[model samples]
Target chain A: MELLRPDSAEAAAAALGNGSVALAGGTELVPLLRDGIVRAEKLVELRDVVPRGVDGTRIGAGTTLAELEVDPDIPQALREACSLAASPQLRSMSTLGGNLLQATRCWYWRLNFPCYLHGGDTCHAKAGQHREHAIFGNERCASAHPSDPAAALLALGARLRTTSREFSLVDLYRLPTDEERNVTALEPGEVILELDVPRPEASVYLKAMERRKWSFAIVGVAAARFADSIRLGLAGVAPIPWALSSVADLEQATPLLGTAYKVQIARALVRRAVEAVSAPAGA
Target chain B: MVVELTINGNAYELEAPVGRTLAEVLRLDLGLTGTKIACGEGHCGACTVQLDGVPVLSCITLVHTVGDREVTTIEGLREHPLVEAFVEADATQCGFCTPGQIVTASALLAANASPSDDEIRHAMAGNLCRCGTYPKIERAIHTVAGDGGGS
Candidate 1:
């Protein structure tokens, strides 16, 4: 029940090194605490440090999803992804760093049910109602990574800068195995300082949702095409956003449940996004 | 921990419990009943409030994170033109989501004095009206936008 408001990222990391979790935006952490999914006795408030340090390509960790939605410097694909994420109010409260680090939104996990992630013997979603769960990378778990912006970030080839180290957006996530519960590969005490989002020549983000607005993606695609290379990212069908090397890679995909239909949707989306971005400026 | 919050231009120092949501502190501790709490999660937008003029969901926002920033709840709203527009347009059907709708719409109008239909729709997409008064709600916002929101 103690909170430490650190003035700098280094101090925040120091507190985190001491076992205090970082709280920013609180869009994800507070709910977990309320639901008893995780317990934290001490917290390091990065409120002062998270909003600083932004450039044309670098976005501060404290930047809210709503801020990213309107930032002109961010690529169109990333902005579109942020805009499509959550509702407006939630976006205003959710930070880019928090969104990337937020836990899976699987109903079983959020409800505090004893599942595989919670140290239960088995993943209940594997056998239970998993229509909204993952379709790819369901080796041991079926929960999909819930962050919409993560897919766009991955497609943009974004790099995460922490207090101590830097890593690609793709390296941040890991599919759960039988032993580990942590989703992100970030080591303890590492505070995400900023995200380096490159402005591609052309990019587009498309999220297939159950609703027109404010629903998680059934299959999200972010495709960015440079003059020389192409980058594609997929969400809602995997434990992590799959940053594919090419469109043909979709053929290697193994879908969970009857959501193989998602592969067709994903293919169409990738084509649409690539076409939208690859089109001439006037065309 | 002692947390200082500036709500409705009034400064108050209160003992904030760790993991306590801003919605709980506002309604339970500070007695600001106007900010409704429907979905305790961040989805509903029923607990929308202005954190330094930006709309945020208090249901998921931790009270300790408020720090010294100003929070504007529906109770603190001072009869703005957006409220009047809602009344004129009969935007409230069930009245449960009206507070959040008005609060969110007010932020939108404040940022863009003349938001178009598409802009209005995108800006207010977060606040759900299960009563299906979205058309009416957008109309109310348009009414205020055309009038410059009473300046």
Candidate 2:
């Protein structure tokens, strides 16, 4: 185990390869490493490598969730999503970039079960206990994307800049395929640098969690109303942060036996979120 | 890796692995056992500590990533009003979650001297009391906030 503290983003990107992992706030990666769920020969610390703070619509990826939640300049959906994502301690320690890359909270995966995500033949949750599993895109894996902010960013039509290229946030995620078991579309050595979010006319995020505070969403929805269009993104429904063409898309879910109840929660949340963002100012 | 850490107003040099968490260093190496590690993951705030005055879960925070920021543990909060308040308000059951609870509540009160009841609940939501002593904990925080000296 080695620690590489690169002073530049280019250097940090260069250092990440061949079993070396990037360390942001260590809120997600460290625990995975400790539990042996993820293995790395070296850790490239990004505290000094990546940029921080917000400049108009450009938010540096190193910005912490706590910082984003309270920044008045940040969009309402993103702020609310960050606020509702995790506990106070975790929000203070987790970065926006790292939050986007966090793995699923499925106990089967975290417990080192031989699931498809772990390169095993079977997705344990598909046949086993899947109360918290996905209601959509569960053909290959039953895990739900656990990031609340990623769904909000998807609704806001956010674009991300990496060390190599820039792309829409929607392109940053994909359902796990047989060839590639990972959910994210990021290349191995590329580092997330910043995010550009276009301001919307109105936006809101609503989450349904098992507990009132400090719990992962059972169904999360983010709605962003643009000049001519409205976009809705969902979390805890699919292997990736799910974007909906319309509220009717909620009907397309293929839920497992234990996860059938999530479809109702998704439909209700989608309707309410869209309604909240669509309402007139001060209405 | 040899790292220099500023903890509880003192600077110390030590050799630790890159993957070693700050909670491990605080409890095992430095003998600051006041910081508890309940869930080695970040789910539990039992390892809550101050990183430059902001409450963070030390269980998941890598010691090597701490840099030059000062780390304050429950031991660092000597004679703080919250300690006495927790006792007077009967906030502890088994006392395992007290250090972490006090550390988190202290940070909240420091930022907002007169936080509303809702504000207190929101801030202290992370630090779980398995004994279900939340009402007492809220009262203790309110007592220190000078809010009518607790219910």
Global lDDT of each candidate: 0.84, 0.91
Per-chain TM-score, chain A, candidate 1: 0.94
Which candidate has the top score in TM-score? 2
Best candidate according to lDDT: 2
Write the residue-wise lDDT of candidate 2 on A47-96 in tens digits. 88798999999999999999999999988999999998899999998899
Off-target runs (Cα >4 Å) in candidate 1 are A17-19, A51-53, A279-283, B147-151
**lDDT per residue, candidate 1, B1-151, as tens digits?**
7878999998888887777788899999999988999988888778899989989889888888887679999877768877888888888988998889888989998999888877887888888888998888888988888854332
Candidate 1 clashing pairs, residues 3+ apart or interchain? none
Evaluated at residue A45, the lDDT of candidate 1 is 83
Give me the candidate number with maximum DockQ: 2
Candidate 2: Cα lDDT at A125: 92
Write out the backbone clash pairs for model 2.
none
In CAPRI terms, model 2 is classed as high
**Lowest summed lDDT over 10 consecutive residues: which window, candidate 2 chain A?**
A274-283
